[model samples]
Target: MWNHNYEDELIKCHRFAVGLAKEIDYKNQRLLEMEHKYNETMATVCRLKEEVKSKDTRFLEMKQKYNESSATVKRLMNETDLLHSEMRKTQSINRKPDEALKCKKKELDQQAKELEESKAHNDLERRSFLNDIEKLKEELQAQEEKTDAIENLNSVLLVKEHMINQELQEARKESIESLQNMLTGRSKLGIKRMGEVDWKPFGDICSQKFPGEDWAKISAELCSEWQEKLKNPHWHPFKKVMENDEPQEQIDEGDEDLKELKTKWGEDVYEAVTKALLEMNEVNASGSYAVPEIWNLMEDRRASMKEIIQYIIKQLRAHMRKRKRC
Candidate 1:
């Protein structure tokens, strides 16, 4: 009996060892995945660092240019002041020569001639100086504007990069949260501890809706369908504006429509979509006037249908091109 008890204990120990070994193997797999993710993150960080370095170099170059431009403007300003003083001296000399009671008026005519020539030369110099000043001021303003633009770009780039990283993190967090919720909800339902209002069924239904296929292909197909839907005339604005055809009223109305859409769709997607639409409309309008009715149709169709509106203009362009060829 003692030997049998000892054998049973040995069997239990062997089973425990196998289970522990399996757990260790599972942990090792997870470790490998974590290491792979870490390496990928490091590579991404390196790329970002290089991008930031390039941007910084560009910023420094712009700064240097701006300084040089500012210096040139200051020099021009000084030259302008010197020219003004010379003009004042010439004016005073003109007065003295005209009023001079000495040496009689014998050489007055010659002096007057020389004075006039000097005046012409001085006037030319003054005009040239003023032009130079204006040019330098314009250059300085342009440089300042460029610098500001570059700074804004730098700030925007940094913000966009940070937002991208934040979005990636949020996506991962949301995915994990969703997975956890799904697991918990499933477990609750399985154990009969879920309420009538529990959403497990809905979650499961949604999960079933996604086919186990390439999501990229699925997205492409969906976008193509949307594009087709947009191209359909059912959504087209009758008498839509073209780039060369937009009247002031129509432009204002379009701007209003854009504002409304932005209010409705939030900013991002609306901004992207509206800007594209505006470009298309501007191209179609091309500084030409369209009827108010046409403008109204555009406003009406834009909300309910965008692709159809674009398609109509596309057709018009094609028709015009054909006519021109004929």
Candidate 2:
């Protein structure tokens, strides 16, 4: 009986041990599965940590970029404010010049209007002055015509006076001749003794003396000879006498032809002819002493007193006309 009780106790003990071993094996398997799941979870946790680090780096870069953008925006706003200030100052500075330009434009317009008015006034005055000048010219022409008519009348009166004086001189000469005839106790017909001189013989002698010379040249030579003779102090044609202890000139009876010519033409006529010949020689040493003819084709005769006066008037009128034209 003790052995059987002991064997039963041993069997119970072995069976309990076997059951514990099976529990142990199940616990080991469950633990292995838990460990594998933990490993996988740990790996997932590491990946998550790396993703968070990368995200943190990107966020820091974005924050730095945002700060730089803000700084740039602030600087741009300062520059815009400064530019606005400068524009306002420029506008203020230009305002005065613009106003001055407007004033200057107004002044130029006023000056232009004044200049146009002055030009119109000048034109009107010039036209009026031209009309006045025309009127003055007409008055001057009429006055000149009146003066010319008066001058012509005066010239005619002068010529008539000269003719009257000539007639008076001729009457005085005739009276002198009559007195000379009575003094000489000769007939009145004997007063004309110049015809007895035979002037043709004297002319023939002059022609012989001066060959190839015309009457004009012979006369010039005679005038030169007389001029030279007159310069000689001792070559007096008249006789000299002592009267009151002073020398007096008297007629030279020895020169019958000269005395006859002097008695026939009067002392005044003889002196006038001599003076005229001397003046002609002095004025024209080489040219003819004869007067030029107004009409070369007309008859060779002296111009009448009326003709001479008419010629002088005509010459004066022609000269006045030429002066007016000029």
Q: Please report the candidate that would top TM-score against the real structure.
A: 1
User: Candidate 1, after superposition: displacement of residue 140 in Å?
Assistant: 1.8
lDDT of 1 by residue, 8-43 (tens): 999999999999999999999999999999999999
Q: List model 2 lDDT by residue over 106-223, tens digit each.
A: 6545554554555455555556656877999999999999999999999999999999999965654554443342323222111222101223333444566557768546645544
* Colliding pairs, model 2: none
Return the top candidate by lDDT: 2
TM-score of every candidate relative to the true structure: 0.23, 0.22
Where does the lowest 10-residue lDDT sum fall in candidate 1?
Answer: 188-197
Against the unseen true structure, what C-alpha lDDT does each candidate score? Answer: 0.50, 0.55
> Quick one: how many clashes does candidate 2 have?
0
Q: State the local distance difference test value for candidate 2.
A: 0.55
In model 1, what is the error at residue 151, expressed in angstroms? Answer: 2.3
Q: In angstroms, how far off is 251's CA in candidate 1?
A: 61
